[model samples]
Target: MSKAIARRGIMLVLSSPSGAGKTTIASRLLEDPGIELSISHTTRPKRKGEKDGKDYHFVDRETFTRLRDQDAFLEWAVVFDNYYGTTRKPVEEALAAGRDVLFDVDWQGARKLRESAKDDVVAVFILPPSAAALEQRLRTRAEDSDDVVKRRMRGASNEIQHWEEYDYVVVNTDIDQSVASVRAILAAERLRRTRLSGLKGFVQTLLATL
Candidate 1:
């Protein structure tokens, strides 16, 4: 009997402007058994119903700073006056164990991850259909103040500019469709020849048998 070839795990990253449905898509993708979400550390206050080490690893400014100083984060960034970071240790362990890790971060974090782990990173950018639609989604959520919403709208243009940097782009006009597109991307990325770590040995063994 032939042994199965081993493969390395992927670092799947999703990024979008505020209210672009990236978070929703990321949540749905987590249902897949092949990938696990990377729990991020943040200085932002936990919202209602949020759990520690689940939604985010909430930490104080001092703690966050200490981790940052120690180079413990794979990627870290400041957003809306709060520090958010993906820790290095857990993600490294997951990848080493052949478990794909999902990252829901902004473009800055995505760039850093790609730089740090070029071969393992697969980045996707999500975009809202239009400016009007983006604003409408933000208003419908009712989670942010009018002033904050307006600020986000202003920042959206800047965020969209980085879309070309990602490996794939998905327009989030329909949630189900967007999710499907991302799932396809993940499936294809997993099969890339470079990622199949043991393929060379497997092929050599097969050739020997012949």
Candidate 2:
């Protein structure tokens, strides 16, 4: 039997505004064979469809601050004035087990994630086609009040301005097309030569046959 290659898993970070098509993309990516979603810890209220651990781990401000003090977060950020964080242990464990983690966060969290795991992290910024479309999408969520919608739109411009910070920027003009783009990026990253741990031995074995 052939020996399997051992490689550290990729940390795929995807960030967008509250209604910037991130959840849809994130859900689709989690269905992949080698990927796991990092369920973030948040101080925000849970949405109707979200569960305690599935959507986000809802915690009080005190718990969030305590975790931060302990350096438990690989990345943490405050967006729309809500505190959110991703713990280091879960991502570390997944990579050690040869599984990748997908993170849905803002630029604030993405910056910290890159700092912690620069070698293994691939950051992607998802952008809406236009400001009008982004605003329209936020309103369609129906959970937000008009004031909240305005607030989100204001924050979105700031977020979009940081697109160059990402390794990849995907304009979400079409849902299927954008997701396909994300899929392509993941497929390529997984095949990088550095990720194939047993390459030296595999090459040596092939040379012996010659």
Candidate 3:
């Protein structure tokens, strides 16, 4: 008879500029049942087709401020005048139960998560093939107005500057290839010795049988 070995989960963070395909990659990754998305709480207005609690826990500024004051977030950040935060309770619970949590956050949020939980974090930064391609993606998506798209383009440069801070960098030239690369990273990280809580005991038992 064999015993099931317990494993601890990792915090997989995917950060990128506004049009660099991080969201797309994340969506594909979520198709796996072992990993779950870390749904964030945001003060930003929900976009068309966004469902509350599913996309984000949309709240007003007052509620967000209260939660921040209570230290309810594992990590929080302000981007483009909107507040976004990951709730501590849900993420902690998931990690403890061996369910990996995926984060689609900015550099600031990534920094905070690392600072708080360095051992469990595996940060990956995604980049666009070129500035031209980034702009074209943003325009073609049509999710934002002209002014918003311009602002995002300007912000992309600043975001890309922090690429070196991440553990891995993926240049998203092709969507399927980029996703496969990320999936590989996740697969490798899952085998890291530190995350396997039962390895020592499992090994000891196996040695006894020998």
Best by TM-score: 3
Query: Candidate 1: lDDT of 118?
Result: 89
Ranked by TM-score, the better of candidates 1 and 2 is: 1
lDDT per residue for candidate 1 within 1-210, as digits (tens), equals 133878889999999999999999999999989799999999999978789999999999999999999999989999989999998998888888778999999988999998889889999999999999999999999888999999999989888999999999999999999999999999898888888888999999889999
Candidate 2: where are CA atoms >4 Å away? 1-3
What's the TM-score of each model vs. the native?
0.96, 0.95, 0.98
Better of 1 and 3 by lDDT: 3
What C-alpha lDDT, on a 0 to 100 scale, does residue 165 get in candidate 1?
98
**Residue 153 lDDT in candidate 2:** 85
| CA lDDT of every candidate | 0.93, 0.88, 0.95
lDDT by residue for model 3 (1-210), tens: 133888889999999999999999999999987999999999999999999999999999999999999999989999999999999998899999999999999999999999988998999999999999999999999899999999999999999999999999999999999999999999999888888898889999889999
lDDT of 3: 0.95
Which parts of model 3 have CA positions greater than 4 angstroms off? 1-3
Error of model 1, residue 145, in angstroms: 0.8
Candidate 1, after superposition: displacement of residue 156 in Å?
1.0
User: Model 2 lDDT vs. the true structure?
Assistant: 0.88
lDDT of 1: 0.93
Q: Which ten residues in a row have the lowest lDDT in candidate 1?
A: 1-10
